[model samples]
Target: MRLYTKDEIQHAVRLNTTVIDGIESAFTSLKTKKVAMPPIMRIDIPANNGEVDIKSAYIEGYDSFAVKLSSGFFNNPKLGLPSANGMMILISTTTGEPQAILADNGLLTDIRTAAAGAVATKHLSREDSRTVGIIGTGSQAKYQLEALTHVRPIDQVQVYGRSREKAEQYKSFIEKSLNMRVDIKNTPSEAVNNSDIIITTTPATEPVLKAEWLNEGQHITAMGSDAEHKQELDTNVLEKADLVVCDVKEQSLILGELRSCSNSKLINQVHELGEITSGLKPGRTGYNQITVCDLTGTGVQDTQIARYAYQQLNFKEDDYNE
Candidate 1:
């Protein structure tokens, strides 16, 4: 049928538009009014000094199926290859036919994740938010910053990372690109101490930001914890949060920040991000409220994005038949 490279998808889909649309569609599906998104299945394959993960998901209402195959590409340093590589496949739901292929798994994933953050920010962050803090300095960190900037003024940014070099590099990149001053902080505490909005995108096994480091009137988006042993915030931080919303409650409880605090029943009253998106539940009650949105990542997002890619391709039976 039709094919779309990562560049084409980037040109065709705008971050804010795609994100807002995906959130609305996904939440509508989750409410059981329309849409059908099955759980995502992932397979990890060990490679030469690294591993690759293949993920597959399906959305019913959109009449499409998608499979994302990507790798960590950690061996790039020793093998002279990129650190990450992958692609996605979109299949027509009407006739179970192949529709389109996209070769930028990383880019697609980043946009969807950022969009999820935007949705959370729109619902949870205070209307007066201006300053933002980012606790990682990688590719995903850039998208996170860009997505937040699209939603808020973000006059000031505080960046923290394990590597001072990378942190400064990220700061320079964003400042030059966004034309906004980015303050490079030496420590995670420094980044979160006085920020109005915070985003954590690290792969730390232990807590990096302590509960005491946070202030009132702040919103936190924890986007790095996607596996069982990954965590970026102190369990006590979650306990102190005024409200904790997750992309999916079941997935978060198993692999997100909720896993770290499982020993205690402190996160019992958690709500899903979809519920907040649907307006079924209230977001931030006041400017002083402490809100946390734990995004463990979900297949529903992949499904919705895949559908968007298919529409962009303008797939038709004639193209396939030819």
Candidate 2:
């Protein structure tokens, strides 16, 4: 088996149209091909403000599958370490042998997660979406914006973060890298009021974005809630949406914004994003409709992205000492 480091994986995989298409295809396969993806296994370490999630899946036509382990330690920055890091192990489907070890250090997860956000925005948001509201200043805040540019005609950005320094840093990076107009807002409501599309990338256990802050023709993508206690959107936000979508309905109900949603009828009406991608369900039926997509991350994304990364790199047996 081949072993690849984070640098090698980062060199091969990037958040671009091709990578976005690969993730979009994974959602399509999830709906049409009925890929077997198990429930996410989670381990929480409250003492260190950390959590580890294990995800895996088997796609029908793929030669290999991926079992990914990703961790998030919110206090890592204080220790001079990244908040998120992990790796992926690819196992052969036919012979049950290991194919490769992608020591991506969570780069693949970050890319695929943002790519999934892009896919959701492409299908669920308005065709004329140009202005975006960002509700966090973390790495995902940057990656999600980069991914959105591929699908929407995004030109303006409004940001709201708990830290002024980090928010300013985010604004500076965005203006320099994306060449877009970015303004830092004092509150989340201020950011939400001015955008056609809003993305929440925080890991707060309490609600960050309120339902009253949402408006007609606005699409919201809440991607920070991957654990049972984590939340980003107020429960009422889901109730007010004209349509609510998720990467996987089952996972969403357990680990996403839907977990806070207590309305039984609304839960039944929720649609999986894959169904919309596969053309089984309609998306954004009306120009004035309010839409929301809750992404909890998925293993199908890991499998497809891992495969894509492997295919893009050149492997040599001499590179690693056995």
Candidate 3:
């Protein structure tokens, strides 16, 4: 198998805004029946201090399977090790042959999650959206900002985090990298109230953005809540949404925003991002509508992105053994 290092994967895989575009195109194709993807299977392992997960998924027509193993970085501060690490494997479906292997671990995952947010914004956010708010100030936050800039002409950004230093750091980073003005806010509510579009990327177990803080016509993308117990928005906020969409209905219902509101019968309707891409569903019926897209991450995305990365790098199975 061809083995690709983290640097190799980073260089070979075009990420951020452009990759988000590609991921959108891929989902659109899937919606158009151009590609087929199987259900994603994920295994979560909770340790004494941290957690690890292994996920595998298959893409139809392409005849290949992609698997990813990832771990959290909670204990990394003391160990001097990066919090997250993992790898992806591409296997041929025709002969069950191992193809190319990428040591992406979490880089590709972050990019795909950001790309999902971009896809949702393109279809759900108002066309005149100018102000954006982001909750969280980690690596994923960077890609989320980059992807948002590609879809909309953002004029101002409000960032919120528990750590003021990190929030200020991210604000400066975005201002320099995207050349747009960014402001650090003291509270999550302030960030939500000040922006037209809100993106949450933290790993919060409770609601951070409340229903009362949101206004009509604002679009929210909640990306932090990927586990069953993790949540970022008030369950009532989902009841107030004009529309709710997810990367996959099944996955989101179990682990995303839907989990909190599922029992209350508050969700009016839930649709997949692919359906919106296929034009089978309407997006943003009016400028005053509140829209939310909950992304819990998926292996189908990882499979497509991994294949794309391998193809870009011209990776072949024989290279690793040579």
Candidate 4:
């Protein structure tokens, strides 16, 4: 069997419009019965401020399927380690055997998650988008900006983080790599105001971005709340959104931004992203619409990204055999 290390996976994976389109296709596949993806299985190690999530999916008539094991330990960085690490396993349906093991250690997850944001923002945000406001300065924060720039004309970035030092570091990274001016805000509200697109990457149980701070014709992508007890945007903000979208309606109701809402009627009104991307429904029909995309990070994304990783390495299924 072929085994890919994290270094190789990192080298193979890239953020681009094609990656975003692939993720978008995965969603459509899920919507159209071309994929089979089960709900995310999570186990929490609360004593250590951590959780492990297991996800897998199968693309119909595809060469392989992928099972992913992902874990997040929030306190690891204090000890000079990354907070999240995991791997993926590719199994051949044609041969019904193991094909490749991508020891990516959550690298593909970060890429696919951010790439989903790029797709959502591209379809939901206004065409003239140029400013981006972000909360959190972790790896996800960097990926979010990098991915969004692929779809938008981002020229300015506003950042709000728990630490001024980390925010400054993020500021330097963005300014150098993205070649854009960054404003380090004292609060999320300050960072959110006057931005064309807003992203929250922090895993906060409480709301970080207030609903009242939002303006008309802005798009928000909340990627932090993938599990229970995690929320980044105010519930009222979701309630007030003219068009609230989610990657998966079932997953969103359990853990995404919709998990906080009290109104069942409003919750049922949420649109699945696949429905919009597949032309079954519309996305951002009006310029003044307040749009929000709740990203829970689906298993199909893992399957598709694993396939991309395999292709990037030029691997053939016949090359891996017992």
Which candidate gets the maximum lDDT versus the true structure? 2
What digit string (tens of lDDT, one per residue) describes model 2 on residues 1-322? Answer: 9899998888777799999999999999998885889888889999999989899999998999999999989899999998888999999999989888999998898899999999999988999999999999988999999999999999999999999999999999999999999999999999999599999999889999999988899999999998788999988999889999999988888889999888999999998988999899998998889999999999999999998888776543334533
Ranking of candidates on lDDT, top first = 2, 4, 3, 1
Q: Which stretches in model 3 have alpha-carbon errors above 4 Å? A: 16-18, 29-47, 263-265, 315-322
* Local distance difference test values of all predictions, in order: 0.79, 0.92, 0.81, 0.89
Task: Enumerate residue pairs that collide in model 2.
Answer: none
Candidate 1 lDDT, 1-322, residue by residue in tens = 6677777677666677556667556754665555444444555555554555556655455678677766665568677777777777877778978877877657888888888888888889998888898899988788888888777778889989989999889988998988888998988999997899999998788988789998998999999998777898898889889998888887888789998776455666888887877778889988789999999877667767777766655544335578
Model 3 scores a C-alpha lDDT of 0.81
**Clashes per candidate (backbone, < 3 Å):** 0, 0, 2, 0
Give candidate 3's TM-score: 0.91
TM-score of each: 0.90, 0.95, 0.91, 0.95
Error of 3 at 78 (Å): 2.2
Selected candidate, larger lDDT, 1 vs 4: 4
| Residue lDDT tens for model 4, 1-322 | 8799988777667888888899988888877776778878889999999989999999897889899999989899998998888999999989879878999988899999999999899889998999999999999999999999989999999999999999999999989998999999999999999999999999899999888999999999999998888999898898878999999988888888888888888888888888888888889999989899999988889998998888876643334542
Angstrom error at residue 95, model 4: 2.0
Candidate 1, position 127, lDDT: 83
| Residue 80 lDDT (model 4) | 96
